[model samples]
Target: MEPEKLRKRINELAAKKKKEGLSETEEVERAALRAEFLANFRQAFRSQVEMMQVFDKAGKEVTPEKVREIQRKKGLRDD
Candidate 1:
C-alpha cells in the first residue's frame, strides 16, 4: 500500500486502541508493527535514492524494464 494510506490506517488503529485501552502486551505489538512499517518505508526510500544517484552518475533513464530484469536475474519473483 501507499505510505499515506498505510499511515492513515495506522493512525486509525492507534485511535481505536486508545479508545479501547491497550494492555502492555498489545502496546508492545503495536510498537513492533510500527517499527517494521517504518523500516520498510526507509528501505523503499533508500532504494529510490540509490536509483536517483545511479541516474545522476550515468545520465541515463533507469527504466522499469531494467529493474525487472535485475530482479529476475536475482531469482526474485512476485509469486
Candidate 2:
C-alpha cells in the first residue's frame, strides 16, 4: 500500500483499538503497518543525514568522517 494510505489505515486501527479494541486479524495488520512505517521513516532519516553538510563559524567543513564517506559513496560530495 502507498505511504499515505498505510498511515491512514494505521491511524484508523489505532482509533478502533482505543475505542473498542482490535480483532486478532486487525492487530496483526496494525503490527505490520507499524513496522513498515518505521522502516520507511528510518530510511528517509538516513538519506537526510547522509546529504547533510556541517560547517563552523570559520567556514570550514565539520562533518564527521563517517558521514563524509557515506556522502562520497552516494556521490553527494567530492574531496
Candidate 3:
C-alpha cells in the first residue's frame, strides 16, 4: 500500500479508537496496518541514512563507522 494511504488509515483508526472503539476485526486490521506502516517507514529511513554522506571541517569525510559499514555491505561505498 502507498505510504499516504497507510498513514491515513492508521490515523482514521486511531481517531475511531479514541471516539468509539473498534470491533475485533477492525482492531486486527488496525494492528496489521500499523505494523505495515512501521516496516515501510523503517525501510525508507534506513535507505535514506545509507545514502547519506557526512563531512567534517577541513574537508574530511566523517561518516559514522556503523553507517560506513552498512554502505560497504550494500556496495554503496568503497572501504
- Stretches off by above 4 angstroms in model 2 are none
Q: Which residue pairs show collisions in model 2?
A: none
Q: Write the per-residue lDDT of candidate 3 for residues 1-79, one digit (tens) a residue.
A: 9989999999999999999999999999999999999999899998999999999888899999999999999999887
Q: lDDT of model 3 at residue 12? A: 95
Candidate 1: which stretches are off by over 4 Å?
1-12, 53-79
- Overall lDDT per candidate, in order of appearance: 0.67, 0.95, 0.94
Q: Kindly give the stretch of ten consecutive residues in candidate 1 with the minimal lDDT sum.
A: 49-58
* Predicted structure 1, TM vs. truth: 0.50
Score candidate 3 by TM-score against the native.
0.86
Model 3: residues >4 Å from true position, as ranges? none
Each candidate structure's count of clashing pairs:
0, 0, 0
Which tens-of-lDDT digit does each residue in 13-41 have in candidate 2? Answer: 99999999999999999999999999999
Q: Quote each prediction's TM-score.
A: 0.50, 0.95, 0.86
Root-mean-square deviation per candidate: 7.5, 0.8, 1.4
Summed over model 2, clashes come to: 0
Native-referenced Cα lDDT, model 2: 0.95
